[model samples]
Target: MNSIVNKSLRRLYLLGKTVRWGMRPCPAGARETRLIAGAQRSGTNLVMDILERSWEADVYHESDPRAFQVYRMRPLPIIQELRKRSRAKCFILKALCESQDLPELMEQLAPAKAVWVLRNYNDVVNSMVISFPRTHEDLQRIAQDRKLGGWRTEGMSEQTYRLVSGLVKRHGDALTNASASALQWYFRNVLYFEKGFYQHPDIKLLRYEDLVTQPQRTVSGLFEFFGLPYHPWVHGMVFSSSLRKRPAPELLPEVAELCEKLWQRFQELEKPQSI
Candidate 1:
């Protein structure tokens, strides 16, 4: 009885908390701002850091609960509220691709610009395999524990082995699979580009590889794109060598091969001829 009551109380508390955060207002002067949406691990965080460091831009990190909640409400209201609160001449919101409702959110913030960043599919998968090995393991373990899923969910002792095998077999895959993950990334980029955001007179597409290979050129282009003053600090903030270093064991050749296939597909998509 006590445990049941505790669970009920916790559920009610969570419900109230969600409602409170969900209904919060956008900051004043933030309407009609720029949005940066892309796949996870695609340098979105790096871009956000650079933008935030700029004195002229009021850049919000993923901290705003309202950013996500606004989509649940009518899009226009959130846009109006955001514009009312943003103090900078331009506001930028960054969200991951899996954040699903971003297309609708972008439409609401229309007349706004966008920067879509992408990395090589293999590199992305390699990064994920390294960054969240436990996630791969958990999925397999859960599947086996539940006894209702496919082979990928079968008994798995180590996450790394499971991920490699899963990727090779392409079985009961989750976000951890390089091909699926890469396809998802490609889809997100395609969705916005197809929506005509790239040619919307305000939007621009950026590649993660370019940002790293030509930091100055990319940053300069972005500054020019937004009509913001270019500063030396922005360059310093753009490329963080420490941030890009891989900390985990290297992914095996089989995993790398899968990622390469995804990368090839992305290449075929033809990035905007010029940002």
Candidate 2:
């Protein structure tokens, strides 16, 4: 009950700011959609919550029926209509499932920008095991049945599919749920490279660790990239308690190495490039 009231109060505060800021014309003088994409257990929700506190933005959570149907995005036309109807200058949408199609979606919604959040695989798997107990079984099906089509398999390349299948085959029935969940993380995030996001000017890679440990600077940088005004209160809700809260989930040595390699790649990418 207290949580509900707190959420409502936060909304009221943001709405007041919206009305105050809405009196003036938007700085950009045009609407912009900010797509937040990442694996399910990554820190996408944390970023979304921060942006939702902004006066200039309207948020569409994956559970919002108006923008999503069972976590999959509604049709493009419907999405465009939602953006058109919203009075806020920024339309914030969570598109974790549609992450692989980010490039195409950005082109279709030109003037849109995206941020893909990366969390440590160990932490992500830990959260997934608790939040979605079915993840391991679900991923097992995807590995054994390549024809299974859903958000999990959608946009998955043949190369990645084979890689997952091969990994599962090596472990056979001995694959632990934690390991399966880790593999799920691997294939989903690998698309960041497979889709050529490294060179995509409009897309930014965000590290979950950075956001929690250095919320102010990290979020300020993201706001700058998206051209949204910064608000101190936006990052207030973020807490670092979740970081390494539990011993890293045990996984097969090979799977651990794979996830670690990808994690290091994300860290390297987070560093600023030479001009």
Candidate 3:
């Protein structure tokens, strides 16, 4: 029958398309690729700064146009161009990508390294209150585009924006209180990275608090792990009076519980490993 034939043809076409996609050449490179991934405002930039200061490694921040521009383009080309452009013995790209992409990035780049930065949940939530879009309109725009996600606001109520703003007002830029929605978003990104890369041999997890108190030793260890030379760079790094403390946010009961569980899990991962 015409209907049966049409269905068969459509299925066959899809099968052919998949085959072509699979056949596309994977990226090949001798230059090592390292991904710096973590929740937003978790001090990935500071980590990168240390990496840059302590070693001669090439570091790319997320805002750099090169970071994910070619993400949509087919394979090989992406990493190939990255290597050719960076020309560093090893290339570090700061990317907060999905856990789903971990296997492929490893499979395609084969032996790619990753670094994850962790910070206190309360501090992170508080920092986000200062850093993220303060207006309800800006928050709505982000939800629609979800430039970052697991997906954010997927199951949460839209009133989350109002809740966060209210926290800002009560705490007065300290955000000593957090909304459940913000905690959920943080948990998803942090937990996803932990579960995906916890067992991977090439990944390293660093704590912001440690990096704050003891910069030289921590950075030297990271460079040594990456097989790069270590230098005295942290001495030149600037510190703000704000780094020592924030009035820790008073979290809601459920938000606090989820955040505590996340802390416990990350603590286990933060153990000093051989890089």
Candidate 4:
């Protein structure tokens, strides 16, 4: 009970802080406000690093502890305000918005631009499974969303519990050492965003290979897409940066084939005429 009470208090405090910060009036960013969004194990960070160095923009990554870039740490309004006020020619930021959350995030933050990075499916899923194995923490996040400190049991209906439990039973195999969840996750987030968010006028897509092999041309196009000046120094930064590192599990051949098909579709979708 004490633990539950503490969580409640924390939520209230966060809500209060958000409300306070949001009430103040601030202008939206004049330069393009970008959300560097992609799959968890994809090359979002690598892309952000290159862009940050090349454009010399005010770049914020998932590592920003003070702001909690993954969740609502300093509130969306606060981040938007800071982005507008920053001295950089373009202010770039990122958050983890996958599946259904993408549209809601765009509606709230209303970024003028977005960069979606894609990686090979097998590599992405393998890396995700290795880096983020299934755990109790995953369910705890759902409980937090429910405004409860614990999961499925404390203040949850049996039906709700059953629903969640079914999902885990269907996907979770922590004991099996297989990554069914990662497979589903890849399809869900990748296809969902590609079908929904890619249609948005402000969004841009880039393949991981393109960014690494043809860094100058790809980044120059990104800058042009966002209406920012292409800098000569960006080439140096790209050359200096490292390339993709795949995670442990031997990639499945079937997954690789599916991923290639998706990549081809992605290329087809990227044509300016499609948008």
TM-score of each: 0.60, 0.93, 0.66, 0.64
Question: Lowest-scoring 10 consecutive residues by lDDT in candidate 3?
Answer: 148-157
Which regions in candidate 3 have their CA more than 4 angstroms from the true location? Answer: 1-30, 69-76, 134-177, 180-185, 189-194, 238-244, 269-275
lDDT of 3 at 32: 72
List ranges where model 2 is wrong by over 4 Å.
Answer: 14-29, 273-275
Q: Pick the candidate with the highest TM-score.
A: 2
Better of 1 and 3 by lDDT: 3
Q: Which candidate, 1 or 2, would have the higher TM-score against the true structure?
A: 2
Indicate the residue-level lDDT of 33 in model 2: 81
lDDT per residue as tens, model 1, 146-265: 343232222223443444445534545433444444433344444444455445545566778778778888887887776667876676745545344653334445544555564564
- Relative to the true structure, candidate 3 reaches a TM of 0.66
- 246 Cα displacement, candidate 3 (Å): 2.3
Q: In candidate 4, where is summed lDDT lowest over 10 consecutive residues?
A: 148-157
- Estimate, for each residue in 21-59, the C-alpha lDDT of model 3 and write its tens digit: 346422344557666766667787787766654233566
Window of ten residues with lowest summed lDDT in model 2? 266-275
lDDT of each: 0.56, 0.84, 0.57, 0.56
lDDT for 254 (candidate 3): 51
- lDDT of residue 30 for candidate 1: 41
Cα RMSD (angstroms) for every candidate in the order listed: 11.8, 2.3, 15.5, 11.1
How much is the lDDT of residue 147 in candidate 3? 48
Off by over 4 Å in 1: 1-32, 66-79, 97-103, 134-201, 240-262, 265-274
Most lDDT-accurate candidate: 2
Q: Candidate 2's error at 118, in angstroms?
A: 0.4
